[model samples]
Target: MQARQLTLDVTLPDGSDFDAFHAGANGLALDSLRALARGEGERQLYLYGEPGSGKTHLLQAACHEASLWGRRAAYLPAFLLRQGGAHALEGLDQLDLVCLDGISALVGCVETETGLFNLINASRCRDTRLVLADTHAPRALSAALPDLGSRLVWGPVFQLQPLDDAGKRAVLVERARRRGFDLPGEVGEFLLRTCARDLATLMVQLERLEQASLRDQRRVTLPFARAVLGEGG
Candidate 1:
């Protein structure tokens, strides 16, 4: 199938890369994913983690890295793929790397399950690396199709560890630096205490703060963050 025919025309989001992710205790998993992107090691990898544990980030980061090496790669979340039906996955093996996120969402959908199974087989034939992620272990989601579960774990599996509070702080500070700002230590602490701790939410709030800072011509100090975030007492 021609690339244009496929429903998956996802563009990797900016700042979603290895450098943007704070590996924390998942250093080994990060290394493995980097190697997979470069086509240096295993052809299939399964990653499981809780929300905000960096599963989606790493998957997209892998796709970005693979493209940097001139390999065609796509990061397809199963939720979005489901919207286009199982056929949306057709011909994905033509790419060098495919990162399938939220695989657990495909369990009850027979068409998607079979399509994913077939995609795995076709990927093996084409030597296309596949990276799949879910919030649960392979066994936990295998009740509907044991064979598919077994196939899911046919290669290396890694459970991404959730970052600790300190790690989250570091991520906020580092990510702010990447966006050309300084996230003061107290501001980070205040965000942690007052706002949603999930990296996704924190990042959104950070962008809001950045925009407000630029608009007001002020630094990202604790007072400015409080005012921008509306967390003032």
Candidate 2:
């Protein structure tokens, strides 16, 4: 049998390339998802974290990993799939992994609420692993479905705490390395000190710096970061 070639246009926030993804602190989270892919113990995994805490990144990484393993993985943001009604659950049984982002968006709405419940049940019946990402913990979900709430607690739940300043700096430096931009330690520190602490914001700034560096045909330096940031070299 010929091997299947995987293809996807996975969109990263702010048009960042795949190399720019930072998975340093998310190693354990990835391992948990890998266990799910192997059909180990749990059928459901909940990833919870504050905004900008890399939950979505971890979810995307799981999807990417599953594809590399030649497994069928479907990634759907709950908010986007909810627009299609229950039919969205169709063919979900054929997948090995189902990754849902923004799962908390289904709270309160009767149709979406029921749709998510059905998805979970359908995936469970077929032994499919469900990876769900939400802004808050499952116990904090405001959905009206008691069974869904209870089922969420049945599996391994991981809460991703926000990265500390040092962690964030390491992430930035590592990302810069992958992007082929040699960011000096001092420059990385300068950006972290002056720019927003949020990863999303830092990613945006990094992209801007990438462009500015390319335009000037110079390596990323403290002066370049300061100049692009309008901080005046």
Candidate 3:
């Protein structure tokens, strides 16, 4: 099969705000990334979080920071890379940092599983930092390869807890501000009250809200939010 191309335009969230959803993160996730940034030992890190728990955000931020430090970092979603067959691992050795997201997708297949194992080994041998993100915990992955499971456990693992109601609201407000939309407090609260609480869903809702507000030439009010969300204002 031909290599399936998955291209996503990666950019930092806008606004002058630096408030991160992971601001309080001093656990394995933050520490491991910091270690890699500081050129310390333990170059491999594993991050586990539920969907929309900000795992991808932290990984992307790390990549952005690495770029500022003039280091080479490659972020690839594991699902896409695995679809390209084993040859995908060839050029990754050239990177200073490699981030793999959605790694659970590679669990069952022998070829992809072994390929990831080899990639991890190659990265270690080359002194490249490897970061892996998965929806489930590392020990819970049902991979058939015993060695692969062992390799995953070799890294420092962090579990990203789901954001509380306040945390989710803060994220929604910050994201809206970053996107150049003035989200009123009432509107933000309304969204959290009625829409999906996950970051991914909130992001999509914000994009829709932005379009609706622009088309109607009105600021984002609670009524507008509710009406646009089909919640019957």
Clashes of each: 0, 0, 0
The numbered model that scores best in TM-score is 1
Least well predicted 10-residue stretch by lDDT in candidate 3? 1-10
- Ordered by lDDT, highest first, the candidates read 1, 3, 2
Candidate 2: regions farther than 4 A off: 1-27
Against the reference, the lDDT scores of all candidates come to 0.85, 0.72, 0.73
Q: Is candidate 2 or candidate 3 better by lDDT?
A: 3
lDDT of 1 at 128: 91
For model 3, what is the C-alpha lDDT against the true structure? Answer: 0.73
* TM-scores of the candidates in the order shown: 0.94, 0.86, 0.85
Clashes of 2: 0
Backbone clash pairs for candidate 3 read none
User: TM-score of model 2 relative to the true fold?
Assistant: 0.86
Tell me the tens digit of each residue's lDDT in model 3 across 1-233: 11112212334454311235444443556666766754576788888888987777777766766766788776776555666655655567567777778888777888878888998888889888888898888889988876898899777888888777777777778777766788888877777777877878887888899999889998888877878887722
Candidate of highest lDDT: 1
